[model samples]
Target: MTARYDEIGVGYALGRRTDPRWLEPVVSALGAAASVLDVGSGTGSYEPPARDVVAVEPSAEMIRQRSPEAAPVVRAVAEALPFASGTFDAALAVLTVHHWPDWRAGLTELRRVASRQVVLAYDTALHNDFWFVREYVPEVAALEDSRPSAPEIADFLGASSVRPLPVPWDFTDGVFPAYWRRPEAYLDPAVRRSCSALAQTAPEAVSRGIDRLRADLESGRWQREHAELLELPEWDAGFRLIVA
Candidate 1:
């Protein structure tokens, strides 16, 4: 499992670095914390530039791929964070909870290590409503169905409020479902490789889907169905920031 990230995390810095638009809300949720622990901090995508950040990741390749100036990374998993209790003012898990074999244990570890708060930025079932799932890749939604619900995540963290921050389509951080409005990106091999679902899916199915999408774009079918998206600068695809 750890090896998967090593193989896939090589191009992560160039393809998966955090977008500034989404970073604003995540930083705001940190709430002036002096120090932060970034769990599953692949290639330091969302690590804040100004704050003190300690990143934890199990994949050594990911750690090596991190920005030269990124916070020092500790090779560790979220279920067993290598930090003392209340070691950090805040802890953040971004798009990584679902990847954990034991989600509950990981969340407990995050809550235990953070003195002030735990902020999670992830997707929910609401992502299924996006055009990509509704059109080209319904199987990806099925793959993510196993992820814990937002309410469940909030409850596990003893969260008083579950804030849902709208992630605009212009928010191009390259996580799954971020390219709903830009259907052509899916046809690109490099872009598709960045998605775990597409990367892991049966190659035959992926090839077929890509072929279908190409045909749709060339035949004007995709534009006819989602033409409204072309004129709009942004869209709120169902990404949210849950502050606990």
Candidate 2:
């Protein structure tokens, strides 16, 4: 199935750019690899400067947005990679596995192609932790909770070892949990458009949620309860890098 990346994922590169704080750990998990495979490398967000990276993504729009400096972009799905067996020293699938039709098959493909390591970065659950999910949009949280779990993914990989890395970032990337601390940003249409949940949900539901959020912000109801979050520099919203 073709994802509407062109329509919804258009401003993603500009708004959802990689957080530098997360890069060092993600790249380090790849080990001392010379050649790397960046699976679902949308807009080349986290492609490291050191390695000889090769990117693979299914979305044509996402592939088209790849930087000139990034590795050559290939239009391919994770369930079935186009490269030869053991083609890469390490592989990275960052925040993209949930979109795959067959996550198990995709993990198998990642294992089959990589000689050294396979790093998977994604959030475990968005519903339980953040106030946005617990308060304004529980439906979106329900949608996200259906995604595969970290343990399930690790089992599929037959990982000899699994390490959990923390998710720490400063600014919101227009993604769901990105604005947990900055509730005011969610009121912006541009910010709301960047969220897949808001984009995929029924227009009426999204509009209702937006309207409620707007009312809460205007009445200072959001601040009255979650005013403490403003003091924090970053939050650990159940995001992790699963290194195998």
Candidate 3:
């Protein structure tokens, strides 16, 4: 996974900027935690500004893009954190567990280093149904389904709560599912490159899907089909916040 990020993380910060609204649930879950360990923290985008945060990321390419003023970062993988037991009040893993080669081991390390764990995991049963994946890029769903599900992750963490994190229509994170309401965002090559699912997918598959999507958009077919979505302020893109 580190190698994968090193290859794809070029210009990652360009498309993957922090959306302040996305941090609300994460901070709320952190309660009174003074220190946070952000595992797989790419460019420190989601690390809460108020917390004493330390980031751990394995990819040097991604690390190179981090702001100089961002939280201090350690070069390490989630499976083997360098921190001692109970080093942090809470550990945060946002949309990154599926990238782990041994997610269980990584999550266990989170448990060892922090009293509480907050993970933003997706529920594929709901996520795979999103029109972009269900229609254009079924490969993304196929790839993601092989990873741990929300229930499985919550069970592993003994999560106290699992709540859906809906994607606002104007979401700025540029994650794979963040463009549910804005279909044309998928047409942008930078946007595609930013999302790991799209970046990892076969180019031919993605090209074909994008071509079809472009045609549909140009023909106004997509607008007609998903007209109902335009009225929604937010939609559940199957993002789940697990607090333990």
lDDT top scorer: 3
Is candidate 1 or 2 superior in lDDT?
1
How well does candidate 2 score on lDDT at residue 147? 78
Question: Superposing all C-alpha atoms, what RMSD in Å does each candidate have to the true structure?
Answer: 1.9, 2.0, 1.2
Q: Cα lDDT for residue 90, model 1?
A: 92
Give candidate 3 regions above 4 Å deviation. none
Per-residue C-alpha lDDT of model 2 across residues 65-169, encoded as one tens digit per residue: 777878898888999899899999898887788777888788888888997656554555743456876676667766677778766777766666665544443
Task: Tell me model 2's lDDT, rounded to 2 decimals.
Answer: 0.75
**Where in model 2 is the C-alpha error above 4 Å?**
126-128, 160-169
Clashing pairs in 2: none
What lDDT does each candidate get?
0.77, 0.75, 0.91
Q: What's the C-alpha lDDT at position 109 in model 1?
A: 90
> In candidate 3, what residue range of length 10 has the lowest lDDT sum?
1-10
* Candidate 3 residue lDDT tens string, 183-218: 999999999999998899899999999999999999
Query: Which candidate ranks first by TM-score, i.e. highest?
Result: 3
